[model samples]
Target: MKKHNFYAGPSILSEYTIKNTADAVLNFAGTGLSLLEVSHRGKEFVAVNDEARALVKELLDVPETHEVIFLGGGASLQFYMIPFNLMKKKASYLDTGTWASNAIKEAKFVGEVDVVASSADKNYTYIPKNYTIAPDSEYFHITTNNTIYGTELHKIPEVNIPLVADMSSDIFSFPVDFSKYNAVYAGAQKNLAPAGVTIIIVRKDALGHVDRPLPTMLDYRTHIKKDSMFNTPPVLPIFSALQTLKWYKEQGGIKVLQKKNQEKAAVLYDEIDRNKLFRGTVAVEDRSLMNVCFVMNDEYKELEDKFADFAKAAGMIGIKGHRSVGGFRASLYNAMPIESVKALVQTMQEFEKKH
Candidate 1:
């Protein structure tokens, strides 16, 4: 049976990337040494690190004023690091989903945090539109995409305050106005590479502005000064991320990926809208292209378990939704092929017929 992956994080990667990474794990660049065996400080590894950072800049069109650092710790660490480094007076946050709320919690520990807008009352099923931004706040924070609740901010609102985004789930899935953000961080597991590494792109001018003391590793400047080698980095994930970025560049970067991702989401969403057994969980305008969430109709709710079982039997995996909202979630990242989406739609159609 052919397998299709729809896992959310640590999700599917390009077959080309997987094969090349596997080959490198055995023997990297004909050095007869596995990528795992190489010293991070070696010239070869340094080249890998440098190219990875460069490709990130190219892929995202990050400005010269921005510094891209690939460091350990997931995007979770940045929830605190951003406040510790940037929040001197107060910061504003949009409570879109779990990750955004967590970021707000971390910021409150460092300084005052104002929740400018939130969708919690609606179970984060939609993005809040009408909100006021305080000019005096250090910066406004947002989660670009809500992974658990399958909602996305399609267009970032313009605010006088600098914007900080946690783009862990949707980074590089679409084109972003890099100039509009003061800092952006993402865990590599979703659209970039694998777990064990996080990418931090911060505007250089935003640093050194906070009065709070920071540990050496928590400070972005420390990593920037050492060229992201402040400590031995995650070499394998960085190398794989480099390969993925190279692949992305060859595939025409975010512009091309955005079109493909939209089409992928549309395939499933169209099926959801047309099918009688399923309905979308999020507001149509706020639905995420990365995570397509849906639930069974009231009459078919009793068959939820059966639907999941059938999907599994048909070679579909990870179609289960988040526990916070019960239903089904199909995480279609950049590397997920169009054929996989088609297969999922076919499974949904088949299940609908049976029910």
Candidate 2:
């Protein structure tokens, strides 16, 4: 039986991408050597990197002013790199969750970090609203989706300041106005591909504005000049990411994916609301389409373990919630089959009947 995988990052990928990746692992595109062993600087890998960047621009409708780069060290490196490169003056951040908080910490190390708004008081159950953006601030940073707390900003805020986004969980899951933001970055593991590549799309005008000295690798201009070949890139992951983008394009691109994502979230959220024993964690208006978080009634705490066991026995995996939230979370990314969700809802119904 095919297992229903609901883990958030390094999560499920399309079957076509998986099959192509598997075949390439042994012999890539009729080349004699396995993709895993190919040189990063070779023409084969160069084509892969170039196509991956191009596909991203084409799919997102990124403007001519933007440049896309696939770099190493996940999104964690970007937390520091963004500040180091952009924080010449005061910067503003919206503290939405753990990841956003970490980004604020790194920004403080570089320069003045102003937290314009935060949802920490309510344990990040909703997005904070009605905040002022400083005219003098270098940039305003926001995490588009909160993975741990299961909240998302469906609409990107409009501001005169340069907008920077950490779109790690929801990139390509829906349509985005690429022109509104000065820079956007996402770690590929969640919705794009497996871990190893961090996709950064920055407006060409955003570079060379800061005066701080940067290490060659940390400099955006350095990578831009080299066409993201500043150093040997992650070859296999980039190749796989290209395959995933191709699969996404074949599946009718982001608009179709957005409809599918909304339908998936609606089905799961409807089940959560209809079930008497369960309650959703995030506010209804702010709940995430990617991660659905919920829990049984406090009186039903004794049955938590049994419910989890039952889910596992029925082939549901990674439904366990984060330790901080302590209930259950089902990550419904683009590649997660609708049948898996149907099976999970059926399991929930059966469990409710037993109790």
Candidate 3:
């Protein structure tokens, strides 16, 4: 049976990315050495690092003022790094879900953090609205997409102070106004490459403002100054990312990918709404294009496990939700085709009939 991939992180990757990466693992850049064993300082791997950064800037339309760098720690490390390097005295954050709340928790250790707004009152099913960021705040932070809670900030908030966002799950899913943000960072697992590297787009001018001294590895300036080669980079994932970027450009870039993502999300979301057995978790307006989360209707709740088993038999993989928000989560990332979404919907319908 052919399986449909829906894992939230370390999610599905394009065949183009997978095949090319597999080839490189055996013989990287025409060098006989496996990608896993290649020297980071060698010209072959260095070219991979350079092109990956270049592609990130090109695809995102990142401004000249910003520098793109790939780092070793996952986006979780960024939770502390943002506060360490950017927050001078205080920072403002919007709390929408688990990750956003985690980011807020990390920032508090640095200094004062005013939670401008939060949807935690309702278990993060909706995005908070009508929030105000303090003008005197050092910077405003937001998690643009909540994978676990299945909500997204469809519009970027206009703020006076510098703007920073954790765009881990939705960075390449759509076209963004790169000029508006001082910094944006993402983990490579979701929509880009694999699980080893995190890509950061930081405006050059935003650094060197904080009074506290930063550790060498923790500082963004150190990596930016060295072109992300200050230390040995994640060689394999970086190569895979470059291949993914090339595939993205070949598919007509972000705008084209955005339309495809929207259509895929709509298919599953419509089934969740129309089918008698299931319903969506997040507010309709804030539904995520990357991760479509839903659950069985209240009366049919007992059949959740049965439906999961049936879907498994039907060749579905990784449709189970997070433990904290257990139900069903189909992560429809950039590489997921609409056909797979239709298959999941069919599985849901077949299960409803059986029940």
The numbered model that scores best in lDDT is 1
Models ranked on lDDT: 1, 3, 2
lDDT of 1 by residue, 71-136 (tens): 888999889998998889899999999999999999999999999999999999999999998767
Error of 2 at 352 (Å): 0.6
Clashing pairs in 2: none
lDDT of 2 by residue, 1-355 (tens): 6689999888989888788899999998788889999887888888888999999999999989999999999998999988888778789999999999998988888999889999999888899878998778888999999888899998788788879999999899878787778889999998888899999999888888788878899998899999999899988888889988998999999999989999989999999999887889988999999999999988888888999999999999999998878899999998988899989999999999999
TM-score of each: 0.99, 0.98, 0.99
lDDT score for candidate 1 against the true structure: 0.92
Give candidate 1 regions above 4 Å deviation. none
> Model 2 — which ten-residue stretch has the worst lDDT?
174-183
Per-residue C-alpha lDDT of model 3 across residues 1-355, encoded as one tens digit per residue: 8889999999999999999999999989899989999899999988889999999889989889999999988999999998888888889999999999999999998999989999998889988879888777988899999999899999888888778999999999888786777789999999999999999999889889998889899999999999999988888889999999999999999999999999999999999999999999989999999888898999999999999899999999999998767899999999998889999999998988888
Local distance difference test, each candidate: 0.92, 0.90, 0.92
Output the worst ten-in-a-row residue range by lDDT, candidate 3.
174-183
Model 2 earns a TM-score of 0.98
- C-alpha RMSD for every candidate: 0.8, 0.9, 0.9
Q: TM-score for candidate 1, please give it.
A: 0.99
